[model samples]
Target: MNSPYSQKIVQPDISLTICGYSKVLEIVSNKWTGLVIYAMEDGIIRYGDMRRRIEGISKKMLTQTLRQLERDGLVNRKITPAVPPIVEYSLSGLGESLLVPMKALNQWTKENYSQVELARENYDRINSGE
Candidate 1:
């Protein structure tokens, strides 16, 4: 029996179990993906600039995140020939669509940031018996 997700008219080219949670995980499970998206939302579109914007993220992590975003068609990578070399990363048309949702999420974070900080402090205090 074909699953509901299976194509009806045009048969799917690939067969796999892609649950909703799994799909969401694939998009935002990475620690750096949200940060990368937020950074891009600010109009900075260069590799070095991104590196600086997202502090503490190693080159390898950023490279991996960029590759994933590119593969997912959420980002565009442009290579420019110069005295040395220049590479840039920017959001694609589809990716810009994500800005609204991301911005909303950011707003929620800002609203709850203080509560989260207090909770962390309380947890630490209780655990430390202080």
Candidate 2:
């Protein structure tokens, strides 16, 4: 049976313009990246240090996010040729600019968590008839 939703997917046309929300979302949408950036805010400069602070983040994901941030000119990676290797990651000037806004976001989330929890409870109660 033919269904209206079963049509073959086609790429939608996009103009050569970027939206502000898209730009912000692109930078901050990665779950691990935001935590990494927040961790770096408090002088976290070493690879192992960041990994430890952001518990459960896999090495591969951390590496990939760091690379992406570096490519986006948000973070700087320094390598020291010690006996094995000493590498440090820190925010670049451009990256530091984001800290204020990110911190605001963090603060807002903290402030609104109680309201969010209440909303969720109300939603669950209404939906479950309990």
Which candidate should be chosen as best, given TM-score against the real structure? 2
Give each model a TM-score: 0.70, 0.81
TM-score for candidate 2, please give it.
0.81
lDDT of 2: 0.87
lDDT of 2 by residue, 13-130 (tens): 4433556767877888999989989878865389998999898899999999999999999899999999779999999988999998998988999999899999999999889964
lDDT (Cα atoms) of all candidates against the true structure: 0.83, 0.87
Report lDDT (Cα) of residue 32, candidate 2.
Answer: 91
Candidate 1, residues 1-130, lDDT tens digits: the string is: 9787666657654444556656755787798998897778755388988999998999999999999998999898988999667888888887788778777878999999899999999999889964
Q: Which stretches of candidate 2 lie over 4 Å from their true place?
A: 1-17
As for model 1, its CA RMSD to the true structure in angstroms is: 8.7
